[model samples]
Target: MPQANGHANGHANGHVNGHVDGNAAPLPADLIDPRQVKLHDALHRLRKLEAAKDIDIPQLIVVGNQNSGKSSVLEALVGFEFPVDNGACTRFPTHYSLRRGEASTTAFIKPGPGRNEVEKACLEELSRSIRNPTSFHDLMRAVNAGLGKKVGMERTGDTGKGFCDDVLMIERRGPDLPQLSLVDLPGLFTASSGHQTDEDQETVQEMAETYVRNKGSMVMVIASAQEDIHCSSGIGLIQKLVRKDASLNERTIYVITKPDMAQSFASLKSVVDQFRFPRPAHFLRNQDSGRDRPRSLASRDAEEEKFFGSGEWVGVPQAQKGIAALRTALKEMLWGHTKNQLRRLIPAVQDMTEEAQRGYKRLEEAGRPDRRKFLVDVAQDFDRLIGNAVIGNYVNREFFSSFDDTSLEVRYKRLRSTARALNKRFATAVQEHGKTVVIGRPRPSGRPHGSAPPPAFLAAEIDRLYSYPEPESKCWADYETWVAGMVDDWRTGEPRGQASSMAYWALFEYQSRGWKRMAENHLKAVWMVIDRFIDLALAEVCPDDGVAEALRRRVMDTHVDKLRLAASTTLESLLSCHGRGNSGFYDSLDDPHTSRSRAQALISKIAELPSLDGGGSPRNAPAL
Candidate 1:
């Protein structure tokens, strides 16, 4: 079984590639593979550095049906004792970590609960169990004695409290690059046993789905005696575990425990063969070959003797052989590949960003107008009213003692009145300056002298000129750029309008080439700017009593209700236009770009509104 003359330098005990004491020489600098350059290279370098420091700990999770020796497996691996019983022993996720020299290892055990009240109770049970485990003999006695109590907590059944129903996370210190840690998932269907009432099957199913969805470690399923490992229940659970949305399949390992039962051990191979296990290899010899491999003092000899029959071992030789085979296979599988470890746990959000970029390009080609037109329009209006809008009679007066003393309510009311006045003045000016000019006459063919232009054809032309484009490439680019800019603002705390330029273009394209464009743009732009301004203003508003109290007092003393009514009405009208035919530039914000643009527009308007001081100044205005 030891492979005859297997020496320390032989493949069995040697360091990975056999470079003196396991350290290999560095690769040549010019060995750069272009495919491996840039981001991929950076990723590779990071993985290597992490691997060099030996921090890529494998998480081992133990899972099984009720009383399937799940806890025993953990105890045997760590050479310690975990509470065991005849029925469901562990109830929640428990983490175990240990240190050996400079290396470390971690393991996690995840379980389900029968009731909401039992969750916290079970978590405390797991914590206490790990901190104070019974002796090996006592644990063995408890297991053979049948379901006695909880594995980790002191309270039993209805009395347990404060248990968290989550997977256990364990970390053990060993070599810098320790073996993959283990995880023990709870029995698939037996989480609700000791409770007084029937459990919510839906709740358990949801919990199971949540665990599978968020699993950060390589998964392993436990196979035991009495339970048909190949039954629909088992296959269905395994199928659920393997299903994935990304480019790669979730890796799973199957372990057949309690092989001491001949019925299970005899047919385990046939059952395991059903599931496809990729990257198979073999190294260690089978124990049934009339010999036994010598294990280090780290292995539990007494326990192995008791578990395996007096004349025969308990675990399948194929299973044990499969483990070594699995290790070698994993090493070969992991060679040069940076994925599959825990670090990939953080999803690759960059992919979503790339998809958005492609969408944006298509939107640009759809013949939408740009946002600069809207900005220039607004700027022109400002140019016309600059003298009156900025240098109003009350502009020079002090409205508030300080930024903190100013009332947002008072500020909003004054700004609304001022904005209405300016808008009236601007409209009157435009009306007075209005002059229609005929550019050219139509190329008319023979027709009745008083016949009007064909109404149907005229309507068709109007529709063609004003209709918004269907959702497609035409809207995607602006959306992507908008979303990206919003993300940047979130990260940098910069004023949101920094990204409004893209949104402005998106809206302009929607409005100018369509009908009632100017009116729609105004409504949408004002709403967007108002939303953004409020967000910024609220951010500046101090949460403490001083500023909040001052503002509360001012609102009570002043007619601030009118200001709120105006802002609310303006916003409501803008929102109403969203997704309607007249919406044009102010279309539905379901798309990321639209949402971002809307946010920016709101911020811009809010910034333009008057400050909280009694003088009715702009909050963003330069100091006198």
Candidate 2:
């Protein structure tokens, strides 16, 4: 059993700590611990899964304003001088996954699935170009060229600007490295410059937010202590995100760069002590400060040691002082987050497995060669659906029972309810209008007659005949005039009998016209219900494009059209008989000889009409 390395313990005491003395040599090959190897292997597995499945792995995101020493902090931690330049060096997010292994660096592009064949080919070509770059500088140049060429940003044409949301993943493994994953986002900018427009600024902000806003990510907001912290745009953005989700405050860490250049130590200490930001703040002094020159690894290590050993910083806690400390903290935080994320990931994997199984089962069922059985099953299903619709038994309680449930089933129920309500409204309109026809009297005078006048049959007939003025109906008016002339001719031949028959015919025609209009409205309402139900059923039964088209042509379209035509014909015949041929019409009248008895009988008949249930279906519905 070998002891784990300092990197595995996340204590920042191995190569980083050993280098502080400026004389500690690299760890020997025999000293490479098993525990450290296991951790690295586990992380590597996770990275592979994340890449292959496009899963989100837990990460620490380092974000700061341009020229705020973000690159310096990263270089200090990784001990690698990443390519840096003036005027927006980073146009894409760079992810560094550090681990302890053989001393080597490798880089690759991770494009999203939305990329086209051309973009994929371009990226592959770019990857090969920098496959074994002699230096980081060569790697950076290749990356810029690839991005600019693919996005058409190398030219000033109308295609695109230089900015993109693509990512570059670099894996650096060395005997001295810590087990950590870090994302370096594009630096925040206050204004547009050169080809960068206001839109470019927005793009950068969106990219930064996309990383830090991930619940699985731990955000590190970096700012130079020499600059007013208030001006740190990155800090303001982090604060805004934290405000929306206060739980983020627990995971966010603050890094103050260029601590050696601060104007007043007391002010800096006060800011740290007050903890106004409600997150731990660490102060760091990079190797090269206030100079344009680059220093060697040994020189950088000496600088860090000298600063931490000085009286100014020696009193500060080890956890809040150097790049090594930052690395340790990030490793520990990520390890914990990864454990929790893995626990959550288990259930998700199971769910995905079950869904896949279901899909496979469907495929197997579809592949069955028994075509006749499949057709028979489909026909039976359709027949059951039609029966349910007609009888109003298809209402799904899960959907219709709750107003909050807004599924398709609920919508279909509401549509059917509307059609039924319209039918009831049609019935009510017929009943109400018929009452006026039966009463058959002139507009009532404010003063009532002392006694009811004997049924003025002749006067009532006259009033009812002209009551419905059909200005738009030239043919109807002509027909009514011809009927009235026939009545006059009959009146001349047999005065008493013809008058009685004329009054009855006038009332009959008036009610028939009103009932026909109402019945037509009801028929239209039924047709709407049938049409909508068919559409909804088709969508549910045949959601796939190929199947839906075939089903519509072979079954739904033809079946629904035939049903609609049959329903229309049945309704027309029913309405004609009910309005013009029913014997009940005579019994419901107010003839002088039997007015009182007829009124009593009409009330009893209405009482016997079947009631409409909550499902909108009529109980004991009369046969049409």
Candidate 3:
């Protein structure tokens, strides 16, 4: 690693192009270009602060089909021939940052997902004193080793998963370099054979797609002239995005590699025609023909020149032929691209800054809370929210957002409303089937054809109440006779006159049985609503999901359950008074007509049903 190395002094500076070196010394003004330096500086700060979540930094990315000479193209641009031989596929992306400064190189591994903390620390230490392409291979070996992969295994894990999002960064500063930022991504592969599997193909494809989607990044799509362009996944990938976002047509550079070996230049005619509209214009370039062949940047350029100077591409424009011309065009385009992207970048940063400011101001003036007090405050807040929900007070916008977000929650959180709804439905059901005998109205027949059914969310009480069988009717001549038949026979010690009164009480008691059922059901229904409200209230008041769940289990589950049992017992005891289970059926003996008038009203209510005696038996039995 060297610092402040520049080419104007005329020496090979032992580094890639002057791109994004963060610690490099400033170059003299006469030989300076600030676009790459300035852009990279902003990105470096953004990344260092970890504030780039909403922004896309400008970069150059290399992507193409597998074995499409993608690595060769990256080498010509970045000026280093990496170790891609001996089954060394680029298993992950390599992000190169080169700058014009003193001669030096710094390399590091950006650990990918799923690594343990110890592995991350070890991988982080690989950056020290790395100066060349072989160091890159060593870094990959370290990543694989930390991943517990054996020495010879280059790609897949034991589970057959291959490729990673881990990025290898190499920052270099040298005299021979020009300022440029570039990334070499894994080549897109299709067939899942050998070390690579179906998973590997999807991983590489996704990685390629993600890079291309970043509008700030310029995509260089490398295609081998020897292979059919139609089959090239790199070209196909970019073309797909271009169709969706037409502007990417400008950001994409379709470069044809290995032209020296291509049997027919005419095969790429369609690709050339479709992609050449906005042009730096060249698609053909040759960097190397064999592994570890072109050792220096000088030799790589020489080979490209030799190939184009003769043969099929000789007629191709000088502007459209070699790596030198391609490099110049990319530099010019990237400068303009950086300027345009600033329009979007500036606003995003301003928004992020404004959000930070609001966050700071939004904090309470009180200092850090005591642990005990924090728990108490959370409990009080939950209590207040539950109180509000029980009373139908939907004043908190935040609570409403949580409670009404989904269709079910919208109508469930308000406890009072849920109770009222249950009560109304229960009242209607009682009216239809409450009396043993009705004078006018008949029970509804089976569900009407094509008619809408009751709401799917009706309370459990409603369904249970309907499921029990409707009572049958029997006939008797008059009230006294009916009472005589309904009464239990007088015991040996009991008086005969008291038998008529006791039997009459039993008759009226049996008729009011639906009230006990409905009242008991209403208690169960309200408790059901209470359970749902507690869940919603927890979400609204206690923002921490884990705490809300814990509170529900520890407090609400244990205590609320006991409260429900107590409440149900109290309601059932009260409701049992309506039927024979309580002391006795009480009615006014003062008005002689009072009992008869009430009995007549009951008859009118069920006039459509079979006529009935006020006592247990019907005067006219229903026909079979």
lDDT of 2 at 494: 49
RMSD to the true structure for each prediction, in A, is 27.9, 25.1, 22.1
Would you estimate the TM-scores of all the predictions? Answer: 0.34, 0.51, 0.50
Cand. 3 Cα-lDDT: 0.62
Ranking by lDDT: 3, 2, 1
User: Where in model 3 is the C-alpha error above 4 Å?
Assistant: 1-36, 102-134, 148-161, 265-271, 274-281, 287-295, 357-624
Q: Write the per-residue lDDT of candidate 2 for residues 440-462, one digit (tens) a residue.
A: 33333331222222122212321
lDDT for 416 in candidate 3 is 68
Q: Model 1, 1-624: lDDT tens per residue?
A: 122111111112212111212221121111223343343334433333422332332343444454444554443333333433333335445544333234322232334443222233334444445432223224223322221233223333454322335545444433322223344444455334444123533333454455444444444455554346654233355566555533223344455554444354346556656666442212122121113223331233333444443343334343343233334333333323334542542244344446557656754664445434533454453333333323433342333123343354333323344345334432322222111211123213343233222222123322322223322232456656655665454443437445444444444434333223333333332333233333333323333333334444464214333553565576567645643433233233133334455688877776677777755646563321
Q: Alpha-carbon error at 340 in model 3, in Å?
A: 1.5
Q: Kindly list the per-residue Cα lDDT of model 3 for residues 286-350, writing each as its tens digit.
A: 44333323245555566567877876667778877787667666766777788788899889888
Each candidate: what lDDT?
Answer: 0.37, 0.60, 0.62
Better model by lDDT: candidate 1 vs candidate 3: 3
Give the winner by lDDT: 2 or 3.
Answer: 3
